[model samples]
Target: MKILIVGPSWVGDMVMSQSLYKRLLELHPNVLIDVLAPAWCKPILERMPEVNQAIEMPLGHGQFSLSQRWMLGKSLRDNHYDHAYILPNSAKSALIPLFAKVPKRTGWKGEMRYGLLNDLRPNRKIFQFMVERYVALAHSKSTMLSEVTIDDIPNPALNVDNENQLACLQRFNISPDLPIVGLCPGAEFGPAKRWPEQHYAYIAKQLITEGHQVCLFGGPKDKSVTEKIVKALSEHQKSMCFDLAGETSLVDAVDLLAACHTVFSNDSGLMHVAAAVNANIVAIYGSSSPMYTPPLSQKVRVVDTDINCRPCFKRECPLGHLKCLNELMPAKVLDAYRDLNRNQNLE
Candidate 1:
C-alpha cells in the first residue's frame, strides 16, 4: 500500500497525526506512508518510524496559490499513491490529492471540500481527542469513532536523536550532569493560554532548589516571554536556568526535551512534543480544555481549574481578568510535578 498524508500545519497537530500513520501501518504492514507537509514539519516527520518519506509542501497555510498547488500536485502523480489522507480541513489542503488522482482521498467533511475528498467522514465531534479524529480516518467511513476507546489508540512516540541530543547539550552549555527540568511557558494561540511568567519563575526556582537544572523552550515569538520568566528569577536561580526559547530548532528541542527528567508546560506545541518524547509532564491548561487535546503521555499530570468561563477556546480572555490561569497558581503545578515524579519513582 502506497499512502500520501497531507499533514497538519501546527506542531501539536503534526505530532498527533502520527497516530493515523501508525494505524495505517498496522492495518497494512507493508504500507509506504509519505507525508506531505510544510518544510518546518520535515524534522518532525523524519522522526516518525511509520513515515517512509517526508515530502515538503511548498505553500504556506491558508495560501490558495492555485497554479502552485496544481504544479505541486501534478509533480506527485508519478508516485502512484493508492490513497491520500488529508489531515487539515481547508479546501485548499485537498487540491494536491485531487491533482495527483489518488484512487481514494479521505478526510472529514470540511469547508467546500465535498468533491475534493472521495472518502469523507462527518460528525468529527464524535471523536474527542484530536489524535482520535485523525486515527478514525484510517478506518472505513462506517466505523464509529465513539466506539474506539482511548487505550485502543496509539500514543505518538517520537524517536529521540541521541547524537543530536548530545550536540544540543554541548552547543547550549547544558549540563546533563544534573537532572534537567524543562519549562515550556509560551503559547502561540495567545495571552489567554499563557500562564503568568512569575508562576513559571516560581516553578523554576522550586525545581532548581531541588537540584534540577531548568531549561525554557519555545519559538521565536516566545523569546520575550521566556526572558520575562528568567528576569523574575533570582540571580542564583537564573544561573541554573537556561533560556532556550528561540535558540534551538524544533528537532533540537525534541532531542533536548527527551533528555529532561520532567517538563512543566502550558498547553503548547512543546508540551505535546514532550509527551511524545515520554518526558514526565506537568501540562497546565488555561482557556483551552484538556478534554480536547490532552497530552498523550502516561507520565503526565494535567492541571486545570473548573472556572465556568474557561474552555472558551478564545485567542484572548474575553472576560479580561484571565482568571483561568492567574487564579490557578504555580503551587498546584508544583504539586502535580512532585506527584508525577513520585509515581515515576514507584514505577
Candidate 2:
C-alpha cells in the first residue's frame, strides 16, 4: 500500500503526526508513506523512520493559489498513491489529494470540503487527543482503533545526530561540562501562552546557582524574549547561559535538546520536542489546557492554573489581567523542577 498525508503546519502538530505514519507502517509493513508539509518541517519528517519522503508544499500558509496546488497535485499523480490522509481542517488542505485523484481521501468534516474527501469522518470530537485523531485516519472510516486509549499509540521520537550536536555546541561555543537546563520561553501562538520573561530568568538563575548551564531554545521569533530573560539574569548567570533561540536551526535544536538533563517551557512546539527527546520536562500551561495536548513524555510535570476563566485558548488574554500565567508563580515551577530532578536521581 502507498499513503500520502497532508501534514499540519505547526512544529508540535507535525511531531504528533508521526503516530499516524507509525500506525500505517505497523499495519502494512511494506507500505510507502510520504508527507506533504511545509519546507521547514521536512527535517522533522526526515527524522521519522516511517516516512519514505517529505514533499515540500510550494504555496504559503493561507495562500489559495489554485494553479500551484494543481501543478503540485499533477506532479504527484504518477506516484499513484492509494490513500491520502488530510491532517488539517481547512478545505484547501484537501485540494491536492482530490486533484491527485487518489483512490481514497480521508479526513474529518472540515469547512466546506464535502466533495474533497471521500472517506469522510462526521466528527473529530470522538477522539480526545490530536494524536488519536491522526492515527484514526489511518484506519477505515467505519472502523475504530483496536487499542482505544492514547497509551497504546506510539509517541513521537526524533533520532539524534551526535556529530551535528557536537558541531552545534562548538558553533555556539558552549561547553557541556555542566548539567544542561533548557528553557523554551517562546510560543509562536501569542503572549497568552508565554510565561513572563522575568519568571523564566528567575528559573534560569536558580538552575545556574545549582551549577547547571542554561540554554534558551526557539525559532528566530523567540530571540527577543529569550534576550529579555538573559538580560534579567545576573552577570554570572549570563555567563553560564546560552541564548540560541534564533541562532540554531530546528535540526540543530533537536540534537541540542536531546543533550539536556532537564527542560522548562511554556506550552509550545519546543516543549513537545523536548518531551520527544526524553528531556525531564516541566511544562507550563497558561491559556492552553494540558488535557488536550500535554507533552508526550513520561517524565513531564504539567503546570496549569486552577482559575475558572483560564484556558480561554485565546492568542492574547482578553481580560488583560493575564493572571493565568502571571499568577502561576515561578516558585511552583521550581518545585516541579526540583521534584523531577529528585525522581530522576532516585531512578
Candidate 3:
C-alpha cells in the first residue's frame, strides 16, 4: 500500500501523527507512507522510521493557492497513492489529495468538507488525547477502531543519532560533566500558557546551584524570553545556563535535548519534541490540560493545578490575570522534578 498523509501544522500534532503512521505499518508491513507537512516539520518526519518519504507542503497553513495545489498534485500523478489521510480539519488542507486524485480520502467531519473527503469519520465523542483522534482515521469508516478502544498503542519514538548529539554539543561548547536540565520557557501559543519568567529563573537557580547544567530551549521567537530567564539569574547561574533558543535548528535541538538528563517546559511544541526523544521530562501546564495532548512519554511528569479558570484553551487568557500559572508556583514543579529523579534512580 502507498499512502499520503497530510500532516498537522504544529510540532506536537505532527509528532503525535506518528501513531497513525505506525498503525498503518502494522496493518501493512510492506506499506509505503509519505507525509506532506510544513517544511519546519520535515526534520521530525525524517526521524519516524515508518515514513517512506517527507514531502514539504510549499504553501503556508490556511493558504489556498489553487494553481500551486494543482501543480503539486499533477506532479504526484505517477506515484498513484492508494490512500490519503487529511490530519488537519481545514477545507484547504484537503485540496491537494483531491487534486492528486487519490482513491480513498479519509478525515473527520470538519469545516463543511462535505465532498472533499469521501471516507469521512465523525468525531461524535470528543477524543481524550489528540493522538487518539489521529489514530482513529487509520481505520476505514466502517471498522470504527480507534486508540481509545485499542490496546498497546505505540507512543512516538524519534530515532536519535549519537554522532549528531556529539556534534551539537561541541558546536555549542557544552560539556557533559554535570547533569543537564533543559528549560523550555517559551509558549508559541501565547502568554496565557506561559508560566511566569521569575518562576523559571528560580528553577534555573536551584538547578545550577545543585551543580546541574541548565540549557534554555525555544525557537528564534523565544530568544527574548529565554534571555530574560538567563539575565535574572546570578552571574554563576547565568554561566551555567546555555541559551540556544535562536542558535540551533529544530533537528539540532532534538539532538541536544537527547543529551539532557531532564527537561522542564511549558505546554509547547518543544515539550512534545522533548518527549518524543524520550527525554526525562516535567511538562508544565497553565492554560492547557494534559488530558487532550499530554506529552507522549512514560518518563514524563505533568505539572498542572486544579484552578477553576484553567484549561481555557485560548491562545491568550481572556481574563487579564493569569493566576492559573502564576499561583501554580515554582515549588510544585520542583517537587515533581524531585519525584521523577527518585523514580529514575530506582529504575
State which candidate has the highest lDDT: 1
In candidate 2, position 170 carries an lDDT of 83
Give the winner by lDDT: 2 or 3.
2
lDDT of 1 by residue, 114-225 (tens): 9999998887888777888888888887765554556788899999989999999999888979899999999988998999998998888888898889999999999998
Task: Report the error of model 2 at residue 80, Å.
Answer: 0.7
Any idea what lDDT model 1 has? 0.91
**Which residue pairs in candidate 2 collide?**
none
Give TM-scores for every candidate, taking all chains together and pairing residue i with residue i: 0.98, 0.98, 0.97
Instruction: Please report, as a residue range, the 10-residue window in candidate 3 with the lowest summed lDDT.
Output: 144-153
* Candidate 3 per-residue lDDT over residues 1-347, each given as its tens digit: 89999999998889889988988888889999999999999999999999999999999977889999999988887899999999999888888898899999999988988899999888735666778888888766666553344345678988888899888887877886678889999998999889888899999999999999989999888988988998898887778889999999888888888889899999898889899888999999988888888888889899988889888998788898888889988999999999999999999
What does candidate 2's lDDT look like per residue over 203-292, in tens digits?
988889988899999989999999999889889888999999888888999999998989998889888888888899999999988877
TM-score of 2: 0.98
